[model samples]
Target: MSYPFGCIVVGSGHAGCCAALSAVEAGCQRVLVVEKGPKEWAGGNGYFTAGAHRTVHGGLRDLLPIVQNVTPAAVATIDMEPYSSEAFTTDIMRLGGGKSDPEMVSAVVGGSRDAVKWLAEWVHVPFILSFNRQAYLVNGRQKFWGGMVLSVEGGGKGLIAAHQQALEREGVDVWYETPAVELILEDGHVTGVVVLRNGQRIWLRASAVILACGGFESSPELRAKHLGSDWSRAKVRGTPYNTGDGLLLAQFAGAQLTGDFAHCHSTCWDANAPDDRGDRELSNQFTKSGYPLGLMLNAQGHRFVDEGEDFRNYTYAKFGREILHQPGGYAFQVWDSQTIKWLREEEYGDDVVKKIWANDVAQLADNLISEGLEDREAFINTIAAYNAAVQASQRERREVRWDPAIKDGLSTQSSQQFLALPKSNWALTLEQQPFLAVKVACGITFTFGGLAIDPETAGVISASSGEPIPGLFCAGELTGGIFFGNYPGGSGLTAGAVFGRKAGREAAKLAEDIYN
Candidate 1:
């Protein structure tokens, strides 16, 4: 421990693990990883994730070899469309509203497939086809929609366990409860880190330091300062350990800030969940994305956004803000028996969230009134009007079917008429018996602002000089400009892998050159 290490990585999340692993792979010896949280709270935002990792692939055939869950027999029963680099790039640009850095987006999109492969093959992250979250059985085949199709086995916990095993195998020493206080710079170059452990300050000298400690989403002060006053009300969907330490470290080192600081990725979390932080046991189960299968109503008994504007993965992030803007900063997702079964059990099962049940529309509204539905009559009228619109649209299409696996064109609008707030697709009547509703609030996942980084080496860019800072690199949520307002689902982890590897490999090369 007395000798100067080759590289030091901050944070112990998936990105940190990837960085440390890559540094070792690039022939760096004695790499150290320092984490802010205790050993029990290891994985940062990654542990709270569903472990879904989006990447470009050539359909089922290309994915079969990497995934462990799908059997040979099951392969024939799967329908997965190939996701090309072009499609991945377009998704990032489109979701980010054309504000994303095209070069950074290219770096991620281009490396996505290789990153996934390395995670599975090298890191031993058990990859699986996301049947529960991303696929639905249609015509006796599991149809994968959206651009997301892969996930780590057993979700986030499994993902972290795999990384831990990999790190141990690579002989990397990870220090838990060692919160990095500041970056140490000498002659305008980052040389090491100052961390506090058990209230004692200690300096660790290394040739290169990589910041992978995530964003400022958990800090309400930072959230309000950047994302506006109302964003403080959004629930912290991941680890409370992030708290902007990486941002501060970079800022103090004169690193340039980039991306939209005012926006973030969020989702519809269960209203009954703890206000300040996410539950470790429930993890991502607190999400209530069933709106795509039914309707989302506010306290005023009115449908707000189009529920089926796109696949759930594409629309879920931005919709959380819409829910937060609703009356009382919450809303309700309602579904009848027909589409109720379509809701992911992990999210809507009785154990996950409170389910209000009623046999008829009026009774349903009456029941929801207790849960903050303001107008029972308006709620009933809304359902009645929605049902009427669906019937009218159905009549216009004749034999149109409801398919959750595709954009089946079963919307609440016909060629000649439309509802004021139309369900774009998967439109179904809410007249079936045993209607159910679940209360939901906004859950802030991660922020989109951090230090601007060099696309190839993941080096933090200097604010004053507009050049890469010597010995300073970054990855994961701590690095910015690949995203702006929003990002495609599963892209977060992929971007982490893409840039984390770059940061680690390049940091090792710098370390070798300096120490030699």
Candidate 2:
């Protein structure tokens, strides 16, 4: 069947869903969302997300002083800490290596609160306020896809189900398992798409086409081509459907890709294993198990970054960036039993002990030995040395020598707090009964760089001339450099909502102006 849509949105992931919904809401009469996978199947990197959307608005100023004054007492609530807009922007820009587009960054940072409000208030999606009840965090509040499966309820099949329902209500048609193979262009204008479905090729016409199919994380060939040998063998933690289909199609149509050098959650699972469940089990284990945050080390056993820092910040540091270039693109999470126990207890609760393979030092050593991931003697010595420093620091009433990194930054009160904790490096002590070591590899969720677009309209720009590609729009992961290089906590979903709405609304308006 030759299906004609006023606007065709490719890929049914977060960006695609948001784009379609926003397009219909913007008054597009006949909209179509082309999904390459089945409705029940997970699409894009949205499913693997922890669902924390970071914004700088809200009562950030009021909460910053509280966080700064009480962070030591509230370290357990790091996930819930409220950051000011200035702090968030500063950290993001610093993390981006000063390469982020200021205009786009401002839009994303500025629109964050509104996006969160829309998701919570307008979409009726439930979100958890941080442990301190100051900011919002998404933790199992709804299914990964906002609980839209076969029904309108939030607990439905997946996000696509909910997005699809919203689209249908607004008169949008959805073609599942219908992959767009090629773009149909006429007179230097994008007019329609050639889609493959049911073992047959079909033509779907649209006034405008928006490519939101995501990045090339799952495509080894593309990774080799862009990311080089370092990431050639890296495993993916997101959806398998992100094979760069949209990217390839856009490139074929003369679109330029950016941020080929950027990726999300660089340290993930090793995908070389035959039975890789996309690292879901490992991620759950890491999140649920309360492994004390410390520095990661390479096979040669050297500290990379202050593991206590945020994961995203740690990944962009010089050492973490260099580790990605090393063999296996892997590192180890080294911590002691106490931290592990605390983490498991706090994050996973009673289920923490059950999920972890090793409980104490000996069991952990034995477990590492079985996995062939670490040497028992070296691991033991490392812990002993760390513990010795902890004891010495307590007696001396000074910071420990083992961790020079933390000492320089400690204030008087910070030093006192450090001394209070059994004179031990609570964040990185190896003195506990059972030493635990987990083999961690840089698992990239999706590439951050893709075709550049106007931040306001989500219109793809020409690579050579730096002009908008008329009749062509991009959203979600397909639009690169939106976050610059550093990803704000909740910016992924916020970007989808902000830019997706912008793109869809503008695309519909353009379509109506031309074809009405």
The alpha-carbon RMSD values of the candidates against the true structure, listed in the order shown, are: 1.2, 7.4
Best by lDDT: 1
Model 1, 1-516: lDDT tens digits are: 234889999999989999999999999988999999899888888998999999999998898888999887898899889999999999999989999999899999999999999998999999999999999999899999998999988799899999999999999999999999988999999989999878888888999999999999999999999998898888999898879999889999999999989888899999988877778899989988789999999999999999999998988889998998898989989999998888898898888889999998898888988899998888888889999899989999988898999999899998766798889899999998988988999999999988999999999999999999999999998888887776789999999999999999998998889878
Q: Per-residue CA lDDT of candidate 2, range 1-516, in tens?
A: 566677898988778877777777678868888888776553456655544456654342333321213344443433322445676667567767777777767777777666656555444444543331122123422111111011111222233444555665666677888888999888767888899888899988888899988877777777777767666666665667788888778877788776635444453333232222254333322231122244354554444444434333223323333556654465556565445543333233443322224556556555655444355665555445544554544555554333321222221123323322222222444655455555655555667778888877888877776877777889887777754444544456667767777778877887697676
Listed in order, each prediction's TM-score against the native is 0.98, 0.78
Which residue pairs does candidate 1 place in steric collision?
none
The lDDT values for all models are: 0.91, 0.57
Tally clashing residue pairs in candidate 2: 20
